[model samples]
Target: MRPKITFFDTKPYDKEIYKPLAEKMGFDVRFVFYHLTEDNILLAQDADVVVIFVNDILNEKVINKLHSYGVKLIALRCAGFNNVDIKAAKDKIKVVRVPAYSPSAIAEHTVALMLSLNRKIHRAYFRTRDANFSLNGLMGYNLNGKTAGVIGTGKIGKSLIKILKGFEMDVLAYDPFPDNKLAESLGYQYTDLDTLFQKSDVISLNCPLTRETKWLIDKDAIDMMKEGVMIINTGRGKLIKTTDLIEGLKAGKVSAAGLDVYEEENEFFFEDLSDQVLEDDVLARLLTFNNVIVTSHQAFFTKEAFMNIANTTLNNIKDFCEGKELKNEVKI
Candidate 1:
């Protein structure tokens, strides 16, 4: 019998992409549209492997339940694994992930968000459609000479720096382990977080969410930033405290915010809730601010990215099934 793989939180795109790949690779695949929660963990009982996306919940309780059902591997089709309980699955089931599907996809989206917010392109499009061509409230500053503070020098951050360099923008980056050589070669400098906050005209968060990085931007961090600074987050939502960001917007401390992620986004993201009333008060409040552009966490949504994710994820599962070395295994 072929090894069965069950994919949770499956979307139409996932079925379109993964179905063909799994058939060619000779694996039995199941697509579950809803997220993987403890309540629905039984759906994975017959699966030899379980595939999950960013929003799937795999807590200790759920991991234990999967182990009881004989699931051997947990394959994450995306890069981030913060939602999974790595410690709980360490002994029971091996876990692997597609680490770098398409860093450029996210980096490009980051710049897109910045440009849209800065030039008020979103507003301009709507106004023109309504036959109102006045440029009132549409003035925007040039980005050529502005300083951009980029947090975390990972692949995505480095890609963003390259794009910013193309725009002739001065770049300031902050990372716990700074690469002086990379910085010098990229025409950027690594600095401390406080300095980055105070000096930057634009602050972009591209760091991973860890114990140290959770709530990295809060009241105090916002207080240190330059007045009217633009903030962009393509990283984890928890990187910035949403309530503090709302307050910053209210006080005009932050001129604009371009967010592809939100702290409490799991409840609403990747789902169509237009027909239903939004009950998330913090998220609802954010939508009211004209200066804020809240996307549905689509920074990594591109054709190239989706292809890379599907191929890499399938290879991860194949390696585990064939008893080959799990090169992408997430070890505690």
Candidate 2:
């Protein structure tokens, strides 16, 4: 019998890319549209492997249920796995992830947000559509000479640095263990966090979410940032404190914010909430600000990234089932 796999939180595109790959890998794949929760653990009963997304909860309760059903592996299609209980699955099941799909997809989207916010592109397009020939508040600054700060010199951060270099911007980076070779080669310099905060005209957060990174941008950090500084977050939502961010926006400490992720986004993101009132008050308030641009966590939605994510996830399952050593296996 072929090994069975169940994919949760699937959109049309996920089915489009993963179904074909699953067939090629000889797994009887089942795609479920809803997120997997404690109550929905039974959905994995007939499958040997369960694949989930960031929005799905892979807590101990769900892990135990999957174990009872004989599921041996859990595959995460995305990079971040804070939603997954690693300790719970360490002994019972092998956990893996598609660590890097396409860093360019996210890095490019970060710049897209900055350009739109800085140039008022959305507003300009709206006015052009209405035949208004005025450019009142559509002024934008030149990125060529400004200092840009990038936190975390990972694959995505490194890719963003290349783009910043092309723009002739002065780039500074902050990482605990700095990539000195990449910095030297790319003409970027590594600096301390305080200096990055004080001197940078634009601050971009691309770091992973860990105990040390949670709320890294708080009231005190905001105070240290240059006034009217533009901030961008394409990585994790928990890195920025929502309340403190609001204070920064209010006081012009944060001149503008371009967010592809939000701290309280789990409830609203990846789902259509247009008809209902937003349950999260802070998120609703952020939406009201003209200087803020919020995307539905779509930084990794490009065709290249989507295909790589689907193929990598399905391949991980196939390799596991075939008794082959997995390349992207996560060791808890």
Candidate 3:
């Protein structure tokens, strides 16, 4: 019998993409539309591997439950395994993820958010549609010769730096483990967080959410940034404290914000809650700001990225089942 793989928090697009890929790979996987909560852990029973996404709840309890159910491997379709309890799964189950599906896809989306927010494209589009073509408030500054500070010099960060260089923007990047050689080759400078915040005209968060990185952008960080600085986050949502960001926006410390993820997005994103009242006041308040643009965590939603995700996830499962080396395995 083919190995059974259970997928949690699957969307329509996930099914549309994974079904054909899995079929071609001669594998069978079950798709669960809802998130993997403790209540639905039974759904993973009898499966050799469990596939999950960012929103799934895989705490110690869930990891213990999966171990009881004989699930040997946990395959994450995307990068950032902060949702999983690696320590709890250690010695009981293995974890792997697609660390770099399409860095360019995410990088391009980051640029799109920056351009739309800075150039006021979102506001301009609505005004033109309403026959109100006033350029009174659509004024935007030139990106050329401005400084861009990028956090987390990973593949996506590197890609973003290359694009910023094309715009003639001087780039300052901060990473816990700095690759000075790569920075030199990319024509960017590696700086401390304080200097990056104090000097940059635009700041972008492209790092993973870890204990050290959680709430990396808060009141203190904002206070150090340049006045009227543009902030962009295409990374994990919790990187910025949303309430603090709101305060910065209100005080005009942050001129604009472009977010593809939110600190509390799991309940709101990937769903059609149009007819219902949004009880999350923080998210609702964010939508009210013309200077703020929040996307539905779609930075990695390109066709190439999706195909690569599917192929990598399936390959991870194949590798686990065949007892091969797990190149993408996440170690505790």
Q: Write the per-residue lDDT of candidate 1 for residues 214-274, one digit (tens) a residue.
A: 9999999999999999999999999999999999999999999999999988889999999
Write candidate 2's Cα lDDT for 1-332 as tens digits. 48888999988888888887889877899999999988777888898889999899888988888898999999999999888888998889999999999999999999999889999987788899999969998898999999999998899999999999999999999999899998999999999999999999999999988889999999998899899999999999999998999989998889899999998787779998789988888998998888899999999999999989988988888788789998998876
- Models 1 onward score TM values of 0.99, 0.97, 0.98
**Evaluated with TM-score, which candidate comes out highest?**
1
Residue 97's lDDT within candidate 3 is 97
**What's the TM for model 2?**
0.97
Candidate 2 runs further than 4 Å off: none
Identify the runs in model 1 with alpha carbons over 4 angstroms from their true place.
Answer: none
Model 3: lDDT equals 0.94
Clashing pairs in 1: none
Local distance difference test, per candidate? 0.94, 0.91, 0.94
- Clashes (backbone N, CA, C under 3 Å), per candidate, total 0, 0, 0
Worst 10 residues of 1 by lDDT: 1-10
